[model samples]
Target: MSDLVDKAKNFVAEKIANIKKPEATVTDVDFKNLSRDSVTFNAKVSVSNPYSTSIPICEISYTLKSATRMIASGTIPDPGSLPGNVTTVLDVPVKTPYTILVSLARDIGADWDIDYELDLGFTFDLPIIGDITLPLSTKGEIKLPTISDFF
Candidate 1:
């Protein structure tokens, strides 16, 4: 009897391990808007859902770093849902104050751009599998806003 129960547990574990999970990629990160006090950037995330229904996004947590300094970190709660069987592109807004940008002046002065590392956590509510968090990261340089952008 004990052996049968152990076998059943192993089978269940194998099935769960073989489940097809969603996949995601960070396509781009670009400047969006500039305010008097802060600048906003949009991180474009493309998620491919394998299931046949929409899955709710529990949260999107992110950290933006530049020159070894953390410029911004926060969580976006209940952003929305990922439609099943389709790849959806989501825009995540990351805002940084002028004060923080000033801290990265040395790096910016070198090339007129900011070298950044963005780490993103996409949490989704998956049926039977409970909640799962998919992590994605990207490193790139973003050009600073030019004088023409203000006009």
Candidate 2:
């Protein structure tokens, strides 16, 4: 009886390990718009689903940081669903207030850009696997618009 139980455990473990899962990647981040109080940026995420049925996205949460300081963070509820057996791209919007940007003037002043790290979480429900969270992170510098660009 003990041998049979051990064999069953090994089989189940192997099956779980061999199962294929969906993959996601952050493609790009771009400036979207500038308002009186805040500047908005959009991060593009591409997810490839291998299943035959579409997976519903519970939420897309994001946090944008600069120099170890959190500049912006928010959650997009009920964003949408990922198409089955296809790569789907979604946009996550992040807004930073002018006051927060001003505090990072030292970094921006040096290179006319801001170094940032973006963390994103994608929550989805699989067929029988229950809930799964795909976390992605990227770091880069964003060039701030010059005075001439505003003109």
On lDDT, the candidate that comes out on top is 1
What TM-score would each prediction reach against the true structure? 0.96, 0.91
Off by over 4 Å in 2: none
Candidate 1: residue pairs that collide: none
| lDDT of candidate 2 over 1-151, digit per residue (tens) | 9999999999998988787888988898877789999999989999999988889999989999999999999999998898889999898999989999999999999999889999999999877777888899999988777879889
Misplaced by over 4 Å in model 1 are: none
lDDT of 1 by residue, 51-149 (tens): 999999999999999877899999999998988799999999999999999888888888889999999999999988899999999999999878898
Clashing pairs in 2: none
What's the lDDT for candidate 1?
0.93
The CA lDDT of each predicted structure is 0.93, 0.90
